[model samples]
Target: MKVDKVASSPIPVSQLNQPAYPQTEQPQRPTSVRPQTTIEQAITATAADQLAQLPDIDAEKVTAVKNALARGELELDIHALSSAVMRFHTGHE
Candidate 1:
């Protein structure tokens, strides 16, 4: 407000509030994407079913071992089973 110790009006800011040229249309915006893919939906459903079954299993594994055990042909790999269990608990794999 002071120039050479004199009081005077400041320049107007009304000219600064608007664009120099007119705008003709609204700006374009990107569209939203799908919430989930088909594969993702399938995986979610499978995981849900697995959880709802109360117990987890590999069905093919059980079937393969079934007849083998019945015929006394099943073999236990203690080291492999122990390693798998350790990996599951430790999330190392």
Candidate 2:
């Protein structure tokens, strides 16, 4: 049976023995932050109102597409579809 030696660590032994420097001053941080409650509430309410105005689905369009697919009336361009998907994934316009 043969055995191979393990690779040595990349860091030098001298650097491992060095002492870390002490921090002289503490970093200043904000003690208190005031919340903008009214502004946040107004924004949330506006978003909710806009979302409520939107329809979940267009049933007429969905049914038409489904019927066309079932009847073999719809044709798909695979190359174009794949290109569009690639462009979307790569974030190209």
Candidate 3:
């Protein structure tokens, strides 16, 4: 009886010689230290300036407006209010 020969494969050596994969660069974000002020701060600042100008104004009305602005119950536009203030001052002069 005759026996048939089978072909055998050798292990690949290229994988052992391969260099490590290159690392990809990651995107960097900018670092900021300044803390952001809340909307309430802006509203309060504007309201304070308004209150300062109206020294004889009603305390209750000013307090109500300030509270409303701080709680977001009222919307305060500094630019518009400033313009109104300027107009009021000019009218008085």
Candidate 4:
């Protein structure tokens, strides 16, 4: 019978002395990009301009809306209605 010494294998000297692999380069980004205005600012500016050019409010339309609200005939989701109204009033749509 023969016995083998398996743990006596030698490591390469090149591997021991070699430096680590270089890292990959990343893409450069723009440096002086400006931030955009908020939705509220845009809405306000548009609404102000539109309102300045509008004629006097229609009394009939005001009365119709008031009557509808008083008689529960106007079923409105106020949040959605307000958002839509703001868009229309602002000429943003």
Say which candidate scores most in TM-score. 2
lDDT of 1 by residue, 1-93 (tens): 765954644755776677889789987866965565699899999999989986578888898899798888977788898989989999874
Q: List the residue pairs that clash in candidate 1.
A: none
Question: For model 3, where is the 10-residue window of minimal lDDT?
Answer: 6-15
Cα lDDT for residue 42, candidate 1: 94
Model 3 lDDT on a 0 to 1 scale: 0.83
What is the clash count of model 4?
Answer: 0
Runs off by more than 4 Å, candidate 1: 1-13, 19-64
What is the TM-score (0 to 1) of candidate 4? 0.30
Per-residue lDDT tens digits of candidate 4, residues 1-93?
A: 998877653877677776678677898889988989999999999999999988788889999999998999988788887889989899664
**Candidate 2 local lDDT, 37-85, one digit each (tens):** 7988999999999999988998899999999988999987788888899
Write one digit per residue (lDDT tens) for candidate 3, span 44-70.
Answer: 999999888886868899999899989
**Least lDDT summed over 10 consecutive residues: which range in candidate 2?**
15-24
After TM-score superposition, the amount by which residue 46's alpha carbon in candidate 3 deviates from its true location, in angstroms, is 37
For every candidate in turn, the CA RMSD to the true structure comes to 8.1, 14.4, 18.2, 11.8
> Between which residue pairs do clashes occur in model 4?
none
Best by lDDT: 2
The clash numbers for all candidates, in the given order, read 0, 0, 0, 0
